[model samples]
Target: MTRLKQLRFEVFGVFFRQCTVDHARQLGLVGWVRNTEHDTVVGVAQGPEAGIADMRHWLREVGSPQSSIASAQFDETDIAELEHESFGVRRR
Candidate 1:
């Protein structure tokens, strides 16, 4: 079954959101990422379990080369249906 994950990325530099969108697209995951007013990056990603896991790992360990990720929080939801057709960067 497809898995859905809501992720919040706390990053210490710029361009994390763009990197996130790129990574998600490359991973073939669907979701939307945006920069929060609180200086955090947030998004929801849904796809195969393995892709979700890879995204989680990337959020934690390997964000944009210009970004220093402070932390990543992931919440797995009961949703099994795809919510988005592609990954995108949402405007604040």
Candidate 2:
């Protein structure tokens, strides 16, 4: 089953948001990621289980080499539908 997940990343430094977008798109995941007002990176992703897991791995382990990720939190739900066609970065 496909899964939809909302993820929050505590990233220090710059460009992690862009890295998130790049990684998601590369994984063929559909979702949106953006920087929050409180200085956190947040997003939602939907895709096959393996792709989703890969994305999570990227976020947790290889997120922008220029930035430091303090924590990554993910909330996942099994889904019967997908709401996004492609992954992109949003400005908050």
Candidate 3:
């Protein structure tokens, strides 16, 4: 079974796009993370059950190095297939 998880999160303290992308890829997800013009980070991740769990953990602890995540919301849905192999930082 495959799934698509959409996460809407806010970075308050200090977060960069590169670290965000690396974290998602390490979690074995496919999609992209981008810094919104509003200063929040929005991302979509698609992968297995445990993989997605890793991503969630990462998001929750993203600020230890220098970033502070104010809040995050994750919504999961069934997707027939994923459009990519691994998560990334999207231009859009």
TM-score of each: 0.83, 0.83, 0.76
Question: What tens-digit string does per-residue lDDT give for candidate 3 at 1-92?
Answer: 45555444555444667787777777767887788777777777777767777777777765347676776667766666776877777776
lDDT of 2 by residue, 3-85 (tens): 55544344443358888888888888888888877667888888877878888888777788786777777777777777888
In candidate 1, the residue pairs with backbone N, CA or C atoms under 3 Å apart (3 or more residues apart, or in different chains) clash, namely: none
The alpha-carbon deviation from the true structure for residue 52 of candidate 2, after best TM-score superposition, in angstroms, is 0.5
Compared with the true structure, what per-residue lDDT tens digits does model 1 show for residues 25-60? 898988888887877888788887788889888888
Cα lDDT, model 2, residue 72: 74
RMSD of 1: 2.2
Order of the predicted models by lDDT, top scorer first:
1, 2, 3
**Each prediction's RMSD to truth:** 2.2, 2.4, 2.6
TM-score of 2: 0.83
Q: Which stretches of candidate 1 lie over 4 Å from their true place?
A: 1-14
Candidate 1 lDDT at 47 equals: 80
Q: After superposition, how far is residue 38 of candidate 1 from its true place, in Å?
A: 1.3
